[model samples]
Target: MMPFSTSFASRYSSAAMLVFALLSAVAPLAFSAQPADNPQSPVLPKSAADWRHAAIIDIDEAYQLSLENHPGVYDTANPDFLKNLQAAKAAGLALAVRVEDAAGYVAATQAFNVRIHDGHAGMSHNLDAQQLPAERWPGFITVWRGDALYVYAAETGGPSVGAEVLACDAKPIKQIISTNVFGFQGRSDEAGHWWVRAPRVFLDRGNPFLVLPKRCQFSLNGKRSQDSLVWKALSQQASKWRTESYNGEQLEVGMSEPRKKLFWLAMPTFAPDEKQREAYRLMLKGLSEHRQKFLEADAVVLDLRQNQGGSSEWSQSFAQALWGKSRVDRRVAAYGAKTEVWWRASPGNTDFVTGLVEVLTQQKQIEGAQWAKIQSEGMQAALARGDKFFVEVEPALPGAADAKLDVKLDVKADVFGDPPAFKVPVYVIVPGQCASACLDAIDVFSLFSNTSLIGAPSSADSTYMDVRTQLLTSGLAEVIIPNKVYVNRPRKNGQVYLPAIYIKDLEWSNANLLKTVEADLIRRKQ
Candidate 1:
């Protein structure tokens, strides 16, 4: 969610910059300087001497630090947010003996983070921190799907795709998802997001009940199978995964066959780029030219499986082009009534004020043209009165029945445009990888009368987003905390976003899933 920045080095005085550096040491982190609310804040390593300064954090200190410093505990509007933190604190305390090393500390905090159940809040072990057992968890990638654990993709000679796991160390697959996927990962309702991930974490961390042995047992296509996985070096493992390869290319839109009457549009990201934006416009032009063909087509596949996220502007642009100008009212109506969202400025966080202006303008709560004038006036007034300026945002209710305008009378002008929407069935392919703007796209696309979502449940749309990062006192890890809670229905109810149609056969592989969609579309036509 880091916004595209033009070096505004001239904007801040050296004194103000110094204030921010000092404030970072103590100020409460909330929303970062990004509009979509998920910016990755910079995390710097401690002094070289400090790296060797080994200190043991007791259970009491750990719990107290989490309660005070965790963004999930302090920034969320959810009433039960505190209760969840307290429960995790108590649970971690009971297991405090494990906190002897940095790896153990990460496991403890990660468990606490998962309990918060907001995907926006997380901790990344400092690159210098001791590696965890799970960091070395063998090669297989397991995905959790509706109580069943299936091998989606695996390293060569590892578990075969489609293999079902009956148990790990004799615990049922259901228990693994409940305790490890949902419980330990803090994924809340998004089990599919952590299916393949939880197995590795639980096995390496020595989770008391759900641990996986070196030699695992499972069933492949209803036939019993076993595999022995050996520990592989990090460099070797990294190479095996091919992190440099482009997965999106595998799902890219192919040439449209004029006679077939079906179109596949693969959106790799919603992040704003001039070329991508132009490409989007051309796509709209092409679709509009084929109006009758699109209307009569069986389905148009909006591939968003590999999209991590980007600016919401791209999503909004696509929406306007697809539906034409008339449907803007209905689209705005889906947001429901606005709810109060609040934030306080810290002495050093001038960037937040900038971000606030952008968000308010986008939400139509404030006039965009006068944002600079208003911000300047507001700051001067607050300074004169010797008062800390507090900002509040009113966001429309997300996907509710009584949806009404939040602090304004109308939707943003950009939502309505010249290009009309394709009056055909839209199938949005969202695998577990979707988040941020991708989730925002889901919200917009879902409003269409003919749109339907297919694939696994998406990564939990942690409505509480935009991280403010803080370095742990131990210097072993950086806690990424989300400051703003998106005022949406799902956040209030503690739920994850679900697809309209859950595809059972499609595993984690994007290539396999896209092919399945093509086959399903072809089958429907037949």
Candidate 2:
């Protein structure tokens, strides 16, 4: 039988699911709708005309004006070098029109990206984007019972959908969000995504999670009713539920006790690891054997609010296990003009001949050789004709085949083939800190059936391209390179392809997207 507990969170009611697809009665736009370019953002050059007519903004100059130009990068040599290269590119940033402050920088960057169609690129706001009314975040937290911090809540369809704050700054995220969201007003609650995420458009800035302090006090609407003793025990034992592993790619696995029937999984990276691979296998196996139990659960929450992303393999695995099918066909293709045509190389290997004279195009390319090499630029270097042979591979499906993409994946996402079958509702939780692979994960996963995004908007819009560069400074220890990300498609094609559910702000800040299924299962058993 099901026993009520105040500590357990995110239960599903068949009745609730029926109405879950709706948006909140109050227009979130009031707080969320801010003009492009926040005042706090840096002013950036817009058009080629502006740059030519105005002061020359070198990569270093632009660095001072970009969102990517932060001190944290300097904390370590690797990040510092990356930021320096990023800074150099920032100098040459093409703007629609330069605005006054940081908000303007972000606003113009986003607007321009949308125009050219670059979404995966990053954007920083200026005064203009920051001009929206300040929003308020809930101080308390609502955690759906799980191993990670995933606390499930309804996809925002109404005011009642959010978690109720029970304490003053009582959750780990509350403090962090407050600290990291640099431009946000104390009251600003814009959940952080751009208005339009198109090709070449850049958006998403700041690391919001690191700021969240460790301790937090909270309460659950449903968790308060059951046996006080056991419920209290669960609450006191809350620390045991907290777990994180930088070593593993997958995260969180738990069955909600209060919500009894729901199951939960929170993934935080695109990089899939061995443990994560095994956990996923086990999860699927468990579901197969307990199909009745699986079918019985009211909801299943997949929490990824803190997920930064790991691998394309994991994304596919996730689609298959949950929905039992995918629509994408698995084929890889690439189209690029190679001056050195005849020869094509694979991921590993080396040496190439560009009409014989092409020993190496750039010093960069030569230094970063994949494998083996020709003796020299000797014209005699006719296609090494040696036992040495390398296959050329480009993006027929860059975003489609994300394995090669670092900052930006090619268009289709890990290459061609689509996923099959996915009626199980999905709720993606994005935060202000969401970027790169994390944003890609959100965008790609949204294509599945019954999918909705909650929390904050993505820091990136899936637009534009960024050139990865490594700085040449003394501490420059790693390679800094930028990936130019261009948007490949339009937004809102159809309901099946859209986010059926969305949450603007976390009133209770509990992000357990799938556990709602488990919670329902438990309740039903009662």
Candidate 3:
């Protein structure tokens, strides 16, 4: 009836509905029950003294506000979203006993966000007001090693590397993981990534809020090591140590070795500035020049570990350069998932006009005649007639209700460039933390049989994006949330994108990981 197409309907579960709601619309909901912040707002605490002098009520108010505004928990139709909120609430009951003052509230807020486990959902606090854990955990760097938390690196005091960590601060490590959740995006491996900073996870230097214990008790290799923490505000202590900086390069290309026939490329993020954009162009130009060489290389390892995401344009462009001039039928091979309108944007529900325009344009999925009609009718009129528009697809996996939609849209074919597709086997090495555009690369690459994923599974691919930042009613803190939601390939409740090779021992050190992968590549060549 509304330009619906049955061509692609069979691929999607019936329950998927696409809806759009901006975070700004919830400003009133966040502040309505709380005191408003303005020029005359309460003067925020300036230091630890000021924080001590400040009222605990303010911190509580901010914490409550963040909880109410968490998009994953508050307004989403996704059933999993609420479980996070429930977990946080249950954890809060235990935390309440520990919260003594404003600092406690800040810690509670962070714990709340961590429990939610969506990387995009986070709280920003006033750093000057709260005293942060200045020093890091002494000796060993703890990480989630496979299923258990283990000491992956040693700087000074604790167990040797490879020893399993039984507990911390007298609490069993498994118990800690079960009670307090710390992670990124929607994947457990990404959550493990945050755990790698263990005990460090409790320290936020600038936005001093989370606090760690003065000492941690560890049982490693059947022996207990009591590691005492020496706290120093790292910012004040200027040490001679210098860590290498990757500088957020969007696209990096090179070879593992001069003698090796393997090529290496790392794309940390796709959100590029002018320089990064130019660099990507230059990379394509370079690839074009060495087209034959690249095609002839034994294999190409595309590193997507640190790619937190950016514009999809870069992903598309890269695919064109590599895959070149391929045609994909969206109705068949590419019908990964679908979006359904779970909520309408009428006046009774929300600001109808804004909602209609966003739903029509945000996804870029709707086009041709129906899109033009919506445009001609204007947003207000379209809302009156109940017309919905969607643009490009977002991230979402099929749910139980995804199969029953009354109306559906035909997916468009994805057509690439005219260049010769790079026939070299492409190995996508994703050691988790990949999202947004990085997932976009996976989607496009999956179409080719030559492409294979190696290393750890990725952070759960979030179709939900467009993070909206809002200052809390306290003015001392802000909350960041993603207003958009996407559908993804259906997965088990806790499942993630598992790599084909499934390298369990990959470490945080990129150099170490590269060496491991490089060795495997050389063996493959043999």
In candidate 2, clashing pairs total 149
Ranking of all predicted structures according to TM-score, beginning with the best and ending with the worst = 1, 3, 2
Candidate 3 runs further than 4 Å off: 1-42, 45-77, 80-102, 115-117, 120-122, 126-135, 150-158, 169-171, 177-260, 327-333, 336-421, 487-495, 502-511, 522-526
TM-score of each: 0.68, 0.38, 0.65
Better of 1 and 2 by TM-score: 1
C-alpha lDDT (0 to 100) for residue 283 of candidate 1: 75
Candidate with maximal lDDT: 1
Candidate 3 residues 444-525, lDDT tens each?
6666777888765665544334444455555555565443334343322233566776555625455555566667767767
C-alpha local distance difference test of each model: 0.51, 0.31, 0.47
What are the root-mean-square deviations of the candidates from the true structure over C-alphas? Answer: 8.9, 18.7, 8.9
Q: Could you give candidate 1's per-residue lDDT for residues 1-526 as a string of tens digits?
A: 2221101110112222222222222323432222234333323324322222322243344455445544345454566777876776566554444444444454565676666555554454553423434344466655556556666557778777778767656656666556654555645455446533444432344444234455567787568977766755444544344331212234443225423766777677665357766777777777656666666776777877567775445555556556664464444443533433322233322344455444445556433313323433454454456544333322222222243334253343334353444667677877665666677677677766778787767765654444456555544455554433344432243344577666666243555555666776677668
lDDT of 1 at 313: 50
Window of ten residues with lowest summed lDDT in model 3: 1-10
